[model samples]
Structure formats: C-alpha cells, structure tokens
Target: MSLELRSVNYPRRISLMRNNKSRLSGFTLWEVLVVLFLMGVLLTSFTPYYGSASKHVRLQMNRANIQRIEGAAQLYKIDVGTYPHSVTDLVYSQKGMSDWQGPYLNEIPSNPFNSEQSYQLDSSGRVNNSSAN
Candidate 1:
C-alpha cells in the first residue's frame, strides 16, 4: 500500500523541544570573591586605631568618674565628721546618720573598664588610691 504515511515521529520531537526550559540562579565564584575582597578592605581601614581609642576613652572616663566620687566623699566627710568604714556604709548607715548628708551620689561609683568590680574603695569609703591601674 503506497498510501500517504506522514512521519508520526516528527511531531513528537517538536513537543519535546517545546517542553525544555533552562534557568540559572546563585552567585558565580567571581561574585563571591569580589564581596570578600570588599569586606577585607573595609575591615583593614578601621582596625588600626579602633583598639587604642576605645581604651583611651575608657581610661579618661574612669578618671573623671573617680574624681566625682572623691568630691562627693569630701562633702560627706564635712557633714558626718568622718569617712564611712567602706563604700557600703555610705549606702546604709553603718556608724550613724545624725550628721550624714547623704544618700551621696544616688548609689556608688561603678568601674568603667570592667563592671565585674566596682570602682575600688579603701577600708574607709574613700576612693582606693591604687584602683585605676
């Protein structure tokens, strides 16, 4: 039978070609390397002075705070006739408040450098002369 037989396979190839899809997402190696280099440059610019300036600021601030505490204590002594035995005595009346002019300074001074220890006080409630170092 020499009847017309148009190729059936030809139509299936066209359908398969229509179904294919290609899409791309995510950073290439070059893009990731560029981002890392930019971060490194920024970090290097600020790193040199970052540490010293922070320390200087802390030390100066602590010195000023200690000075303020010293002044408050002087005022307390003038009114009470003697410094309290320790810093705690200022907060709670240990000896007597007959002449106590405080609650001097709301509470007590705190260490600016390490909050683990408060600004040191001597046996008496005065600032410890050696605490800063």
Candidate 2:
C-alpha cells in the first residue's frame, strides 16, 4: 500500500501577516499633522532672536564705519595741519589745501541702520551718526 502526506492550511497566519503589513506601511494623518505643528512652533520661537541679531549686526557695522571715518580724518589733519572742514574733504581735494594727500576713503559709507542718512563730522574732529541716539 502507498501513502501521501497532506498540505497544512495556514489561512489565519497569512491574513494576520497581511493586516500587520498594511498597518505599518505609513504614518497616519494625525501623526503627520503633529510633526508639522511641532516644527512650526520651533520656528516661531527662533524668529525674534534672529530679528534682533540682525539689528545688532547692523549697529556694529555702523560703529565700525564711524571709526574708519575718524581715523581717516586724523590722517588728513596730520597732512594738512587742520581737521577736515567737512566729510567731503576726506574724499576730494579742497581748494588751496596743497598738503592734502587723499582720497582718504574711496567712498563714504551710509548708515547701516538708515540708508537715507550719512555719517557726520563734529567740530571736535569726531565722527558720529546724527540719527543714532
């Protein structure tokens, strides 16, 4: 007599595997929204810090430009025996001032915080920003 073995049925096991795979395939809508919300919160928290940092940087740039103008003025005084009569004197030759050895500065820099304003020179030979208090 010959005997044959029967194949085992695994319908429940196959169905369970398919269900687990479908559930794990991707994130749910709520999960995605929660992640987006967290990212937005982080960005809002950093916005003010970045804005103030940019303002501080502009202020520092203006200060450096002022110092540069002051040094150029001092150089002009040493060469001409007088402080510059105006900011323009540093960049151009003045009438009857034969000792001037400039264009001291290539060009005057505008106030970093205010594009419409320019730096100023005081009678004491110091440079200042008129609009900055």
* Tens-place lDDT digits, model 2, residues 43-132: 999999999999999989987888888899999988998888777889999888889899899997777888887777886679754644
Q: Mind giving the per-residue lDDT tens digits that candidate 1 earns over 1-133?
A: 2332336666777777666532145677989999999999999998879988998889898888788777776777888887655565556665646888677777776777777776666645567766665
Question: Positional deviation of 90 in candidate 1, in angstroms?
Answer: 3.1
Best by TM-score: 2
Off by over 4 Å in 1: 1-28, 122-126
Scanning candidate 1 in windows of ten residues, the lowest lDDT window is 1-10
Cα-based lDDT for every prediction: 0.71, 0.83
lDDT at residue 132 of model 1 (Cα atoms): 60
TM-scores, each model vs. reference: 0.64, 0.72
Best by lDDT: 2
Candidate 2 — what's its lDDT? 0.83
